[model samples]
Target chain A: MGAAKVSADHPGIDELFALLAYGEVAAFYRLTEEARMAPDLNGRINMALMAAAEMGHFELVSDALEQRGMHVQQAMAKYRSVLESYHAQTIPSTWEEALVKTYIGDALAADFYLEIAEGLPDEIADVVRGVLAETGHSQFVVEEIRAAVAASDQQRSRLALWARRLLGEAITQAQYVMAERDELVDLVLSGTNGLGQLTEFFEKVQRTHADRMAELGLA
Target chain B: MGAAKVSADHPGIDELFALLAYGEVAAFYRLTEEARMAPDLNGRINMALMAAAEMGHFELVSDALEQRGMHVQQAMAKYRSVLESYHAQTIPSTWEEALVKTYIGDALAADFYLEIAEGLPDEIADVVRGVLAETGHSQFVVEEIRAAVAASDQQRSRLALWARRLLGEAITQAQYVMAERDELVDLVLSGTNGLGQLTEFFEKVQRTHADRMAELGLA
Candidate 1:
């Protein structure tokens, strides 16, 4: 497509990309800080590794924005409030909570990014695919969650409740974004049958969560 | 040299390496945890990056141990008490203390590692060089320290006092290790006239700290 057509088609792509970039940067910052909450040296190192990987994503998205003639700092500033509020409202309180946040939050982020990637141009899609392929952080989260669930019945119930709470908070914060950013909401809701696509998206996420919970013997 | 001859010549290399490996792991844990003391996201992320870089050192040392048919976990266990005690006693209470600990401690670590690397085998030296090459964390600490020192005269004096306290605690910890682990101390204190080399090492570190203080206009 021509430049004009591409710009018209993906009106809010820059904003969305910028928002995701800031999200990655914030994740890197928060995860690294939270890694200290680990009780053991090994756990701490592994969490740090996961946090560092988020920097790789941040650099990739930032570079993409630069390539598109957008200043990264300015773009990031636009969505800092939304991103910061999300983190502020969803701080993990325990190892289990942290793992649940990493697992559920990362999976949802990957799904959303993947959906957007499919709609973007080839170069942007390529960058997203590259990031999506590096699932080390999510894998660590999954293993930890499964291990925690398998260790004890009481722990499983507690963590399952925590996971549900994290999901709830995430949805609440996401709604804030949707309400405030009309262009972003419109872009996401476009090319779908009203709220049906969104409902299906939520259902798919719930199904995935159920599958994970069953795998961990929590469901 | 033959394996037996090499072991005999570098009798305490294993112990020293093991202690250093455990130190890196512990530092990674402590620094990652200490990142939370940061007053803002930027400071937290900077500390996190430093912690993450230490994990790279941990992996390198762990792999070096494994290559020698040694289990990293077993080696790490040998120095656990010493490493734990050092961190437990020196936990920073404020941002200034954290910055001093990161800046001065990391620089001292780099100097000590560089000194020790000179006497190690080629394979071990290469690992040390690789780990030392990433100085982003050190740069971040320097920038932060400089900014803090410039903020106010009182801030500079307070941070200088904190740095001295950290150094005193570190020396006490080092002496404890030296008294407890003669072999490791011997490895470090070897190749020079007994206490002279040890004294010179301390003096070198002191000079480096002075230089850093001068750079920050705090001296």
Candidate 2:
């Protein structure tokens, strides 16, 4: 509806949605692989459910792009490399690491999107909310992490370090995107407090990540 | 209702659900991997949707077992090897082969279940129907196959032969299951025509397979 504003100073909704759509697709693939590596049946099933939810989120963002008459493939193509690079750099070698990676990465991504959602039009923000709401696997991850750490104190420190590594990689990727796409940064910051919000957004994301780590007994 | 019938002369409903549950779990994993092999984003997304549906079916059958006081994991453990062997023997090397495997395998499995459903009690049969009804990804597969064939005749023959290989493997696995679980085979065949329906069931499965092959221009 407000195409002019979207084009001029706002974060390009198409670009942001495209980035998120591809991210979800990549996550779905990685999570499904992680599900296969799960040590037990229920763990496998839980991860599969999470992977399914990611696909659902991808569909949501893809549909949003389509409603705006953007080609799904073309919109998604540009953002593919950044997300794939992130996944490649942070490949989880174990089920525990996979859980931590999914938990921290997903939580951080959700927070960033929520921040961006605040600046978006009501309809687009609604789509963001729909994508953000599918946290069904969060509790499952928390349970698995705690149970894992409970079995060995070594696992606790190992996973805590892993979480830190994941957060580092995530922040690196986020900064890479922001550096590369000034439009996305503007879209993200313009609604709340402009450039000043960047510090506040990272702080908020860090707080949530720490809270999630605590929930997983890594705090 | 009819616990005696279930225990004495008939295949236990628990065994049936257990078999179906494991099969769905196995399919979810295989399909998820197949989704990754998809050459394009849309194909990947479509396969992920089908994989998700399989997970949903797994949950449905798992829940049914739980409601009957059966341990879901325990119930599923018995049927694991047969399904695993089927998947192990038929790993698809390419995206087209994956599609053919999924399309033909899913259709055959659905037909077999439908035939078996006729002998089940109403409630259990309803569960079977619910699982059988999730062919939502069928049209997506058909479109992809036709598009591939129209683009290259070489792809058509390669896929057609792959479909035949998949069918042979499926029959081999089905026979293995029948040989291993006489109760399951009995459960499968005892419904409609008592013990005389084996030939008729295979004929039905073959007919549907032909129709699907024709739809893909492989017949």
Candidate 3:
């Protein structure tokens, strides 16, 4: 639709879509799996809804990959281990922890995507922008975490520790990803026209994450 | 949109929606949970997408219940144990088994809902019919099961046996429900103009099940 996607010529763009697509599908899996940890039926339903929203985004990006003449599965397979490892290493232990992971993990991904979206071609950028828009279920996670934190000092401190762990795990994985995927690293840096250096870009992301932690009153 | 649903005045209608809504949410949970057993990424994604479709139907019936002035949680709570027990008792041990349970469980529920859909008030019946329509994911299940069965006699025999077990377990719970919920029994019987006796009703359902088994080449 947007210039017929010269995607095959752009390994970086395909990597971008595949990264986004697999991230979404993996999120769908993690959220639904973690729904088991929910303290109540309402909590379980919220996680399931959140998972479904991620699948909705997966479908969008998946279509883009297919239209670009890439096999969705193969493209996604390139990063399955890494992405799944990210979720595996950070399996949320409590309902509050799961909420924190969902909130922080998703916010961090959005910030990273927006960071690189501008460097991609128009078609790829549009697809990225379209699916990155919030599905609004994140607000439920935020409110639930805020309420839980407000309940007790023990709870607040526990989640604060959990959030920092999530952030650390995410940064570790992001660093691993950039080191491994040359195209992705190139794609990310090219979008840094508003930025001066790669360090500044990551600094902005970290600042936003800090703001999110504060919003949850965890900071 | 359809007559604004005079749902509060009709406890039977609320029961119907509650049963359907809880049924959907449970299915959403089960399918996603079972997606863990999927043989490949494709299988997992298929199950996840199927689960998401169930959630979509859940939202429809859930919104319907909320509009009827019923608390969705309280109403759904009525059947939580019974439904959860159904899934807990029949945890599929293999990917093929997961596929079998998914295919059979969903089809059986659909047939039962359609069986009672006719005698309900037009509005409730319409909602039932609307959501009852297959989201088309079943074809994937059927195809997968058939392919697995075609490859080996062991798979064919195992799934056939497993399918009967699912049927028996489902019938036990369903009979228990009819005995417990007077409103549900009355609503079901009310729809029996085309149906002669309750036994005949179940006989028809069984015939359909047999037909489905034949379609799967399992019978």
Candidate 4:
């Protein structure tokens, strides 16, 4: 899991690249899907821009994976079923729900990638960092959520619940991903001293999630 | 009606811009949705590229609408429902159906825009041309549909029927759009000599659609 094990054929490094590649492309599509749920064309267009950003990252990471001789499809295949089922189980029912899901989901994935960046090779970490740089909340997203929450108490409570549910679902999916992929588990474990640090790492992530929710007035 | 009528307040110009803006963004989302149904991640990523192209046009047309001193929302408002219902009614039932629909639907739109480009002011026509230029069938899409059709007689027939249904539904929706929007009728009419040319215009457009289908082996 350390930079010493960051070669293309190394177990966890490939999995990490595969995971991020699929994750970026998947996010691109998911954001486009959610854009339709936006209240208006402007909202939808803004979401489209965000989706386009994800597409850029997708190309970058997929290109990096290809440079490693890993076919993008072959790399993505292993995680496809798990990610599909996770998305199926956590379908957002409304525009606000979808917005929150994308926000939290992106942040969580970014956090995971950043956490593992320590174990990745220099170039790989740089590419991963480049992808995460765009994962922060867009201004329009914050304003939209804040304005919606300000307009209605029901929206506030409902969105707060949605945020919490997103956290739980994301954790469940992440844990499932870690458990299901032995290479990923090894990659992650190799980086950490023990399970205690990993548990703390997640708690730290949740704290950041709560802070983000607070920023949107959904805390 | 003519270049002389190309102003910010013109009736159909706004509608045209609005319709196009919405159409491009809608295609962006729809293509992203369809990308998921692709047989593999590589296919999905290719669809994403096509979707991204639509997003670029969406931005161009949308920016043009804004420069008209018309709010994009207001410009696109009249189209929101009609396009929504059009999509609602013409929803593609499968990946092949979606592929054919996008391929055919985009070609039809490019034809219409090119047909009407003569009546537009030079600048507006230039913008319209820029957007339509990308409307030509992408090579990958042609290859994909052709491969599918070549693989099986059932796919050939199935996609042929889908193409035909797309043409029908497209005509139905265009008629609805024409009848419901008084300005578009006036706009289309003012650009031409009489009802005869308009009917001829549609027939010509349909001819091109057939040609595109043949190119995909779905004719």
Best candidate (score: lDDT): 3
Among these predictions, the greatest TM-score belongs to: 3
Prediction 4 TM-score vs. true? 0.82
- In candidate 3, what are the lDDT values of residues B81-175, reduced to their tens digit? 88988999899999999998988888888878877775566777778987777888789888888898999999999999999999888888888
For residues B120-201, write the lDDT of model 2, one tens digit per residue.
7777888888876765777888888888888988999999888888778887887787788877876765565544567777
Separately for all candidates shown, the number of backbone clashes (residues 3 or more apart, or on different chains) is 0, 1, 0, 0
Better of 1 and 2 by DockQ: 2
Give the per-residue lDDT digits (tens) of candidate 2, residues A56-169: 788788888888888988888888889989999988888899988888888888888887777666777888888877556689888888999999999999999999988888
lDDT of 4 by residue, A81-199 (tens): 77776677778889988887878788888887898787666777798898778633377788888999999999999999988887887789889999999998887776665587688
Q: Which of candidates 1 and 2 reaches a greater lDDT?
A: 2
Please say which candidate is ahead in TM-score: 1 or 2: 2
Give fnat for candidates 1, 2 and onward, in order.
0.29, 0.65, 0.74, 0.61
- On the 0 to 100 scale, the lDDT of residue B4 in model 1 is 16
DockQ of each two-chain model: 0.33, 0.65, 0.78, 0.49
**DockQ score, prediction 4:** 0.49
CA lDDT of each prediction against the hidden true structure: 0.70, 0.81, 0.83, 0.79
Model 3: CA > 4 A from native: A1-9, A193-195, B1-9, B193-195
Tell me the TM-score of candidate 1's A chain.
Answer: 0.87
Q: Alpha carbon lDDT of residue A117, candidate 2? A: 77
lDDT of 4 by residue, B70-134 (tens): 79877776777776676677788788787887788888878887777667667887888877677
By TM-score, the candidates rank as: 3, 2, 4, 1
Q: Quality of candidate 3's docking, in CAPRI categories?
A: medium
